[model samples]
Target: MTTELDLGSIRHAPKVLLHDHLDGGLRPDTVLELAERAGYRELPADEPVALADWFRTAAHSGSLERYLQPFAHTVAVMQTAEALHRVAYECVRDLAADAVVYAEVRFAPELHLAAGLTLPQVVEAVLAGFAAGQQDAAAAGTPIVVRTLVTAMRHAARSLDIAELAIDYRDRGVCGFDIAGAEAGHPPTRHLDAFEHIREYNGHSTIHAGEAFGLPSIHEALAFCGADRLGHGVRIVDDITEAADGGQRLGRLAALVRDNRVPLELCPSSNVQTGAVPSFAEHPFDLLARLRFRVTVNTDNRLMSDTSMSREMLRLVETFGYGWADLQRFTINAMKSAFYPFDQRLALIDDVIKPRYAVLIGG
Candidate 1:
């Protein structure tokens, strides 16, 4: 019989992460040092541990705006190419340490232009960092491959430019395009031009929708924008209902999402921090998973949420008593949903992910 999995075993399992932010996953000490180096004095705390605590406390304010406040400092320090490269490099190191075999780290290039670095320079620096980190990880006997997702801030107007940037860098390290920011007033429809541009190029796009807003935002993202995936599509749950006879009914949107296999990049901890759900137990992940809604767990903001893929999986294991099979399923879901090419994704699933899980499950 398979034994209960511990944090150690979970950490050893090969994992795939699809929706992590480069600006949101910096090491606390790295942020502090970078801020000091860049003369950015707006950070709430000078010390690493205190700064980390401040970020976690501030992000839990139950408002997406409040949760996003820390990015000002992170983005401030990340304006320089050196800072961007270091942050992306450390992100790979951290994820590899967590046994993440593959990840797609995203950040908006427009936000990193405060230092006057060209957008291509910013992308090049980050790609170089990921390459360096991957090489280092391989040398250290824990190999990891990281790709980039070029995100355009939803509140900003540079999305079409950013889409072109993603397309330009597709063969480099960039894998996909995304628009992430507050989803309330800034709908994905506002970036329809960018979405259309990506579609024209036959590129992949994941829209940040249905998190701060509800079904309407999700509707525009899927029905209008044709998102390949939904970033933090947690609020898609709002379209689902339970009947008096204890049967669950999915509204048109939810049914379409499920039937079409649109991946929901559900970041449970980040969702709770952003007030998307009351708490873990109240989260719709289990419901969506039970209904087979192409659910995949993620760490949207590692620093702010004080989380990693392993911790996210462990929390689910503790809360829902998930087994090795459940964990493997989530890993495979994320791997399958990755914007990576189909043949390579399948190769990772069969050659890397499955063998690791089989060893853990004693199969």
Candidate 2:
């Protein structure tokens, strides 16, 4: 409530995160320790600080494929149930420390099967970790609610299986299903059965489109797959044009997206690291926000981008001069778009987000 709008001040403001990756947000020290305990010796750097630096540097290669290369080590160590639980617990603790009141963390269960853990075991382990973390955070007076999004690798054919697994644990802690990985060749259309299954069961889903791919991918996700949200839908900018009089124009697909209020889970720093945009200044987040798209800020990968919800909001505040009101709007947008039940989402917004922002904005 100081009107300073710095990192410390922003961290005190209640925030909602919609697109954090579980495996991608591990603590450097935890990764080193896990690797040592698991006898995994493929680490590029043995030291925690150096390993963290390596991830940031390597992710800056500006190619989506190259940016994803660092996940090999993270996923390698997370093969065991203990490793997965520890990582999940630490993810919630870190986000709670950053003042993220609600977050939907995603990870591919198929990736964690390397150590002979079944899909249900992987989901349960992460969910158990989240529950324990939430209890600890509440006891520490910085409460947070962390939900899981079961992800299917786009290149793999297990999307249907993953979708079922998500639905099976929907009542527990898993909130939704997702399809991720390189978006170029593996179109969301390829997983039509998985999306259709979720829809048949009345489940929620978000597709990883418009990041490394283009309009066709998005078109398929919405028109065909019926995605509830767009994961990194920054490339929707391509469908927006400028008129001769310096006005903005929205194409049919863009109009469809905007008119329907489809949420765009935008991760500014991760977008730049993955070469989705040249830099933060050129990101379409501001444009989409101004256009009234249901835009919500996120941290796609905390370890790779070294970002948190506060850092993401601070970037927008510094670049676009967003005030407390703006940040609150983004936070509310995320809460509304969350896969949580309507009543729970409304309760959090009314009781937590709005009240906290009122204090900051009024001060």
Candidate 3:
């Protein structure tokens, strides 16, 4: 008989993460040290544990605007090359330890420019750090492939520049381009030039839509901006309804999303913290999953949520009674949706994910 899956067993299974943010997952102690090194002392708490508590508590305010307030501290401390490098390195170390076999961590290059570093400089620093972290993780027997997704702030005008930057570094550790920030006023179509540029170059992009906004945001992201995926697409549920027969019915937009196999990067805990969903039970994740939407689990902000891949998966198992097979399906879904090259993604799925999951499922 299959053993009951818990946090320990979940961590042992290989996972793929596609929607994590680089600046949103800093270690508390790292934040403190970076702040001290940079001489930016605006932290709410001095102690590491207290600082961690502050971030978690602060992010639980149930407003997307309030949920984003804690990023100021993390961004303040991650200005210099050394600080960015250290945080990137530690991010890989932490994710590897959590048994995430592959991850695409994104950050806005424009946010790191306050330290006078150029966009390329910031991207280079993060890519170099990821490379070093991969080497270290491989040497330590917990091998992981960490790639970068260069993000442009949705409220900013430099999206085209960031898109070009992502394309320039595509052969490097950078895998794709993304746009993140508040989603209410700054619609994805506002960055039409950038999305067009990425498309012209045959590049990949994921837009932060359907999180803080409704169907229009998701519709524009898919139809106008041509996002390859939707980040925090919990609001896609808005376009779905229960029919009189008690079966879930998909609206026109939802039908298109499902028909196209568009992946929804759902972060359960972060969704609750941001008030995207009333709670985990109310989250559209299980509904989307049951309806066969290409739903993948993610920890949008590990630090803010006090979560890891194992913790996210374990929560699903606890709340939805997801077994090993379900977890494996999510992992494979993420792998399939990754912006990485097709050959590499296939190799990881065939050689790594499937075999490991087969063993875990006792096949």
Candidate 4:
């Protein structure tokens, strides 16, 4: 079991990230460098600091337009094999610095075809980048491990192709399949064929459902497609009903989630910005957590959200007045839900996370 945190010594904490997006986490400096290299100048700001502020402001619009602008720039730079590898490598380097023990990052290789790179080439470049990033992070004494999730654009019709690519690279570092993009009209069932392939092949998957949409989308992702984990699952609250007293009413769907222990990758700030939760106090984070849902906090789109794991944790601490115990509970939830091998996951818990936390809480 994990213990309370001292906050003074958070560097040794074994953090885990499950809902990060590769195209959404570029460093401002790197964004500029890649933008210049790609000969694309859609950025509103020429400097790194201004560029970051610009991204934060755009993302704050809480509209699809704000969410889609930065990606246009990121995807533009990532068209080439070299640029893709470089961005992937730098992402891991940044995560390691943040003391991330394990991270599962996803990107859609199908979108990089504008520069004429094959799907396999895109996957290969990202793998090489992860390998290099791990080595570089280790040398810097901030060791981290990263796994890949190959995503298919939901509005587009490349799910089958991307699913095949993900399976091809599974042993090479790719962990699973995912469907991303605007979820309002393009439901997860639209890519059921690809989901069926992964299901038939025994490949694990987590879908981006119930984020921009509601419980109907999440229902299809799990019931119709058999999602291993839900990306946000924030809207599952639609099925929950609180009573006048301290007791609560568990709707059938909410009961299924609780009984099965599906992980809700809850990013409080991002969810609010995305209109999933409306506001922090009204957010279902405390509600879901108190109901014993397998809830974990995350930074879904760090660049757009202008967030990190530490920042998210600090926000929860501020909002709910959470102590070390709550933070550990959230961290354990993340560890249990990570897409890593069981033995390595246990080893991390026993060796790294448990020890540092024990020292913090004086166990």
**Using Cα atoms with residue i matched to residue i, what is each candidate's TM-score against the true structure?**
0.98, 0.99, 0.99, 0.95
lDDT of 3 by residue, 302-358 (tens): 999999999999999999988999999999999999988899999999999999888
Residue-level lDDT of model 2, residues 277-356, one tens digit each, is 99999999989999999999999999999888899999999999899988999999999999999999999999999998
Report the lDDT tens digits of candidate 4 across residue range 242-328.
788968888888898889998887878778776666687888898899889999988888888888888888778778888666777
Query: Which clashing pairs does model 1 show?
Result: none
Candidate 3: regions farther than 4 A off: none
Candidate with the larger lDDT of 1 and 3: 3
The prediction achieving the highest lDDT against the true structure is: 2
lDDT (C-alpha) at residue 152 in model 1: 94
Residue 65 of model 1: what lDDT?
76
Worst 10 residues of 3 by lDDT: 1-10
lDDT (10s digit) by residue, model 1, range 1-363: 565598877888999999999999999999989988988888999899999999899999897877898888889899887898899889999999999999999999999988899999999999999999999999998899899999999999999999999999999989989999888899889999999999999999998888889999999998889899999999988888998899899999899999999999999999999999999999999999999989998999999999999999999999888899999999999999999989999999999999888888884
Name the 10 consecutive residues with the lowest summed lDDT in model 1. Answer: 1-10
Q: After aligning candidate 1 to the native by TM-score, how far in Å is the CA of 172 from where it should be?
A: 0.4
TM-score of 4: 0.95
Query: Order of all candidates by lDDT, from best down to worst?
Result: 2, 3, 1, 4
For model 2 the local lDDT of residue 55 reads 93
